[model samples]
Target: MTVDPPIRLGRAADAAAIAALSRELIEEGLPWTWQPARVLRALQHPETNVAVVDAGDELVGFGIMEYLDTDAYLVLLAVRRSDQRKGRGSALLRWLETAARAAGAERVRLDARRDNAAARSFYNEHGYHEIAIQEGGYHGAVDRIRLEKWLRA
Candidate 1:
């Protein structure tokens, strides 16, 4: 299905949908369960949270950015499974990069499980470089790979 370009900072009412989609993606990537309420709380907070909505007014994707001094951490970025390859994820990432840059962040970083080959490839393809491999990073069950992308002002 063709989806319209996403609308930014859509609405608070879509937080639950975004959280549910995020939980699904996280669960698929890792063996952990995420609480929807907690996710909703974080997303609804006015700080560095952002979401993208499709023309149908459905929550297609969301991204959370945490600003720390001179760096911005992409705490979460998830797109619904049905919307995976339709440029939603890329658009969300681009928006986050711009937001990070506006927040005085020189770079954006995120960690993906080393075993999640698809995610690793996605990040790499998106201009993020793996700077380090963290041994036994995921509850001592999986390793974590750190990725960072330098943003241009």
Candidate 2:
């Protein structure tokens, strides 16, 4: 038997945990573009919303997003390596989508590294479609596939 962690709205204090998880989940250490300080700033930004999944007292996963009147952008979503495939990432994503829809977002957009077949498949399974591909779109880290999903209005 196994237990799943609880997912909830994120707070400022979760910033460090989320940043660490991002570093662990993503390529080669944390990208310079998403240093801890930058993550903290995003969590505190007025337009952004963040959610974290807790493992005992530590956060194991997180998702961050931002929105305007009728549009939203999924800026980041990461899960601890040990916690992958347990539904934490999907929970955070569902929470973010619900939050975005509640905030009047009619559509949500995100970008994923095209080479990451796992990520691309995850998004596709969740109803997101690839809308574009940009060479060096992600700060030149790699080619990017832009994905978007329309919400029921």
Candidate 3:
């Protein structure tokens, strides 16, 4: 069976799904945490969160962010386990970039675990470059690599 991809602004009800996806990604020994309540709170507050949903009306991925003057820091970007490798992550990222630009952001930044080679490769393919690396940044164990992408005006 085939499924149509849908990208749309997230609503409050999507918090659980978003959190579940995050937990799955991390629990599978990935490199992140899943906090459903925290994510829901952030999502309810438009000032710091945004999400992308699939055609099935399920939250597939989200981007938690914080604005720093003219730039937006992407705190997190995760796709559902069942939804990975289908271009959904890239589409959500593009949407986030567009949204950031519309909000007057000149650039966007995100940090990925240094050990997450898949994520690193994905970001590199999407025009994001490693600008810095924090040694032992994550949980005092795994290093974190900072990446940034400048948007065109």
Candidate 4:
């Protein structure tokens, strides 16, 4: 039987791999804004959490969230193509949400590409609600759906 990969805090060494995964899975067809340098910065940020699913030899998934005074923003979440549908993505998201709630965040917010129905459904399945739809929201290139999940009253 295959064991589920464990999720943990990202390290400085994992920045490049995480950035590459973001470029391939999340930022495809868009400008590669989450480069290694930027990812390292987030990893070093005090208010941000970069979580990864370490699959022994490599990282299979990752999620980056920035916690604010009242809420948290899910900057990105993605799993390697070969590792999808195995619950790694959902695990990473849940880990981040738990961290956000512990930090006193009332809600978690994120944006998904409107064309990616799978992602929309995935977030919705995780309790995220559609808050808005913005045309040209993705770097002024694609329509984006904004989603939010309230954590408390």
Span of ten consecutive residues with least summed lDDT in model 1: 26-35
Deviation from native of the Cα of residue 133 in model 4, angstroms: 0.8
TM-score, predicted candidate 2 vs. hidden true structure? 0.90
lDDT of each: 0.76, 0.83, 0.77, 0.94
Greater TM-score among 1 and 4 belongs to 4
Q: Residue 98 deviation, candidate 1, in Å?
A: 0.5
Where is model 2 more than 4 Å wrong at Cα? 1-5, 27-30
Residues 63-148, candidate 4: write the lDDT tens digits: 99999889999999999999999989888988999999999999999999998898999999999999899999999999999999
Q: How displaced is residue 20 in candidate 3, in Å?
A: 1.6
Model 3 misses residue 107 by how many Å? Answer: 0.8
Which one wins on TM-score?
4
The pairs that clash in candidate 2 are none
Candidate 2 RMSD to the correct structure: 2.4
lDDT of 2 by residue, 41-100 (tens): 998899998888888888888898999778899988988878888888887888899999
Best by lDDT: 4
Backbone-clash count (model 3): 0
Candidate 1 lDDT over 1-153, as tens digits, reads 645465577456766776677667755555544456666666666666665757475677777777888899988788777878877787788878888888889999899878878778889999999999989887777788999998865
Q: Which regions of candidate 1 fall more than 4 Å away from where they truly are?
A: 1-4, 29-33, 44-46
Q: Against the hidden true structure, what lDDT does model 3 obtain?
A: 0.77
Candidate order (lDDT): 4, 2, 3, 1
